[model samples]
Target: MELILKTPIGLEKIAADRLIEMDREISLSVKPHGLEGLIVVERCSDKQALVNYILKNVPEVESLVNVEVETEANLKSIVDAARKVSRGKISEKESFAVRTVRRGRHDFKSIDVNVAAGAAVQEETGAYVNLDHPDKIVQIEIIHDRAGISVTNGFRWKKMSPDKKPALNFFNKISIVQMPYLGSLEGAKEVGARIGRAVQAYEVRELVIAPNKPVDAYELNKFIDGVIEGIESRFRIQCKSYDRKVEKVRVSVQDLYQLVRDRSGEPMIVFEPEGIQLIEAATKLRKIFEEADRVNYLFGSREGIPKGVYRVASMVIDLAPGITLPTELAAPTALASTYTVISMIEQNIEDN
Candidate 1:
């Protein structure tokens, strides 16, 4: 079996060298010059064993594609190869889709290959097409004059991280609830209650409150503790303190700018009505968050974020366009919108 191992551009040689050093049984060759991101491996003693080893040991390798056929890169050649692979692997009762990726200039576009190859696969296997979710995937990769075809039987190849934590459920996310002091004690508590409800509704993991002038750290912490207690008592969920217990409400008191600066390594998104629209911002945020190890969202109070605080912000989102909302309303709106985008992206990742 021939497999295509994809690595970041300019790292193909390093990945190829590592594969050769680790597994002497497999014959590996870096794809010709100009095809800088791919290494072709053939003559593997065990295909699955090599895949597992690469995924576990090679951090440079991004993903692996099982190559069904390595032939000339052309419309006819691609379609014929895809049909042959799909016929053997895809059952007549299953639904399949053709996905083509091109790395070099070609006479035909990727969509052209997809349409022609998809038609050929359908005709050969008598299978219907399901673009969103398919039982089988016919993947065609064209790099200059060479092409690799594969029929994936619902098996996905992902690089494995030994130190990676288990995937998080809805409840496991580490979300921050930023409650800025709104001048009056009654006002702060009232806004805090609304923010607290948002936290409970979204199942946030952490709560951080900023002590604006006149509101000391002790007072802010006590106020947040009370707000959390109220939320628990109201919902009967039994929230735990920062020490960790049943409801699990970990609260902290810190300056908003200082908090953002401290967590600079994590992806940060601030919600401001003057910023970009939420929908477009959410798309970009999803990509950034996916690549980041941690994520934090910042919401402003009536006074708005402290001057120069936005320097640490990676993105500024306008959840409500052309209108300004009070801190209480904006806080929950930002949380709900951000959570919705994250959930949507997570679902897309799972589906694909």
Candidate 2:
């Protein structure tokens, strides 16, 4: 099997070196080409295994794509490659889009490839064209005269092997904290400091904040930007925020759910407290989290979660018994609990 490894532009050799070291027995060949972060790997015994190994061991590798066809770069060749890969790969009921990355100057533009390949795939599979959120992605990489085609679904291409799983699963973790904007801007900044500490402690990368009532977008962004800056002072955890103007907790929660679904093409495992399941046992929570592709933890502000917000939750977990903590405390508490559960899960996996 053949595959493409995407790395930083100048770091292609680093990734290729690691692959060469790992492919001793498989006799794999790595060719760095296009000078555009593309490394082609050919003659592999197990492509999936190598991908898993690279993802776990090689930090420079950004993504991996299993190449279906590598042919001359042109509109007809790209259309034919898209058609061939979409035959059994993309279903008629699924929605698909064509994504083209052109490295060298050519007669055709990238949008031209996307349009032609998208039309061909739609005609061949009867699948609708969805550019925003596609069920299947037909990726075409054109470097000068050569082009590689592959069909994919999600952002994560490498799947970790069971035995080589890491302790902290950062890719699958998401945290949503409700901003306590009911108070003055100073009070909000204080609360932001606490939220920043929580995010840093938990090593969260994606954060979604819901502003309280009477808070506008400008104020919310200003407040949350302060919190993110505070987190950056001590520990470096790159975070992306999903800022919404909704005051209701349910609206923010639903927005986050939709955002995750749109980007990942799968439902996230949402956990919110409804005073039902206790968050005392890490083992039980770990088992539940292991089943999904990712986890989303939701916390409310001073007003607490809305009445019907629990309906969207996959599991309602009670953090504090018979008492509701404030947003500042609740955010950190839930994040710490999740980190502990994931740690225990990883420890158990390592021990076994």
* Model 1 lDDT, residue 335, Cα: 63
What lDDT would each prediction earn against the true structure? 0.72, 0.67
lDDT of 2 by residue, 1-352 (tens): 3787788878877887788788865543344343667777767767788888987999898887788898888889889988998899888999988889887778899999999888899999999997766788999987677888999993433344434444345533554645444456676777776776666655554566654345555556556765676566535333333122211111122343344445453223333455554435566667756675556666666666554545655556777666767667776676666666667677779889
Candidate 2 least-lDDT 10 residues = 242-251
TM values, all candidates: 0.48, 0.46
User: Which stretches of model 1 miss by more than 4 angstroms?
Assistant: 25-27, 42-48, 155-352
For candidate 1, the 10 contiguous residues with the lowest summed lDDT are 162-171
Please give the lDDT score for candidate 2: 0.67
Candidate 1's displacement at residue 343, Å, is 11
